[model samples]
Target: MSLLKVRDLSIHFQSRQGILEAVRGISFDLERGQTLGVVGESGCGKSITNLAIMGLLSDNGQVHASEVTFEGLDLLKLREKQWQKIRGKEMAMIFQDPMSALNPSFTVGYQLEETLKIHEPQLTKVDREVRCLELLKQVGIPAPESRLSSYAHELSGGMSQRVMIAMAIACKPKLLIADEPTTALDVTIQDQILRLLKELQDAYNMAMIFVTHDLGVVAKVSDNIQVMYAGEIVESAPTRELIERPQHPYTRGLLRSLPGAKETAFRAPLTSIPGIVPALNARPLGCQFHPRCDFASEKCQHQPILTELRDEASTHLLRCHHPQEEVL
Candidate 1:
């Protein structure tokens, strides 16, 4: 059985402007030790989808799904108390900004130990301290013992992120949800974090749902990639396959917009999509991406359902009236 399964999951929020659909019906499955990358522009619902799965959505947010299961447990059906027991132990998340995620008042050691205190209560104080040191060391923090006493503000961006990783994985979770975890770091630091995550995932044999706007980052770590537009998945396929043969117009646009995506001159202009993602309350009627899609047609006025490609063996799925046939 799959480690995680989400079927027709939708998330909505009640607002003064009325209901705002943040995530439309979307479904996907993740197997043990597999990495699924959810890629899209900001406000495309990538983060919100995972937040709903983790049961961290606000009270005003309503999640409706035919099925949202993790290890055979119905995630949508789980109450807050039930979710607390599973979070951090069975599943954990690395937020986009480590600085905000970590409390400023507490030392790094205290935060790490608190996670263990709640999840692994059997461990004695000394054991917890040992484990905290081990975690800092595992994440490649220099002088693990000394760093323990340092507060969040004392650490560099990379170090703070490393600390966040340590806490998220302290309990050896079976699944990890990384929401733009490397967005705030420098390019070099981002590379280091990505490599570290890959190593840890391999070591723990954990499944991961990596959410990011960078296609390049996703290409490196994901086994499968899902391209989401405004609140909906536009395309999905094996990482290499999708990267090389993107079918949806939005998917192709994203690739073309990447720096050095094409073999153009050194200083040539980078391609960019024309418009921004629509506001939740002002979204267009049919295909949400149609407004920005260069190849949009009259047929695009009607929404397209996610459908598998013609090849019987291929797992490529697309939701487009005019799927691109050319390679990127």
Candidate 2:
């Protein structure tokens, strides 16, 4: 059975200006031991979608869905108190920035212990300490015992992230939501962390929802990919197929804009999609991505629902009026 199932999920915020639909009816599923990567630009609702799934969106945010189930349980109907029990024990999240996510005052050990105490309160103090040390070592932190006493600021960026991973997996969660866990790190560190997470996922047989704006990072880790643009999934396919045969104009634009093999800035001109993602209040009528889409025609003046790629496997889906033309 799928570990996670989110169908027709949408998220909106009550703002002073007006209601802003940050995430519009985007849905996907993750099987046990599988990773689904959500790739999009900043503000494209990737994080918002996952936040809604975790029941962590802010007070002003509201969620609506036909169904949001985890292992056959209806997650959308869960109360905050009930969600508390499920959060770390059944599903855990690793925030984008460990420095900000970890408390400044508490030692790393204390934070790790908090998760353990809440979920596995049966663990005695000494047992908790032993498990905590093992978690640190599992995430590749050397001298794990000494590091447990260290504060968040005392550890380097990479080390802090490792600590965060350790905390997320402390309960051996069935599902993990890692929201750009590799952000702000150098390329070398980023690679190491991705591989580490993959290793851990295999060892635990955990399903992961990996969120990021970087396509290269997504390509490296994801089994399947969902391409988001303007708050909706524009395209989705198995990883290899998505990379090799992207259908939507928005998806193509994103791939073309990625840095080439050099991985350095500028020699040839960089390709970028024109027009920024529309603000929630200013979202275009008809197709949300129409204004920025190169193949947009009068047909695009009407909205299109997500549909299977023409003549392709049923699993490959896109939301576009025309899928045959090359994306500008």
Winner by lDDT:
1
lDDT of 2: 0.89
Worst 10 residues of 1 by lDDT: 256-265
Q: What is the lDDT of candidate 1?
A: 0.94
lDDT of 2 by residue, 90-114 (tens): 9999988878889999999999999
Candidate 1: deviation at residue 90, Å? 0.5
Report the lDDT of model 2 for residue 9.
92
lDDT of 1 at 76: 78
Off by over 4 Å in 1: none
* Candidate 1 lDDT over residue span 187-255, tens digit each: 999999999999999999999999998888999999999999889999999999999899898888878
Residue 225 displacement (Å), model 2:
0.6
Give the C-alpha miss distance for residue 227 in model 2, angstroms.
0.7
Q: In angstroms, how far off is 45's CA in candidate 1?
A: 0.7
lDDT of 2 at 162: 93
Clashing pairs in 2: none
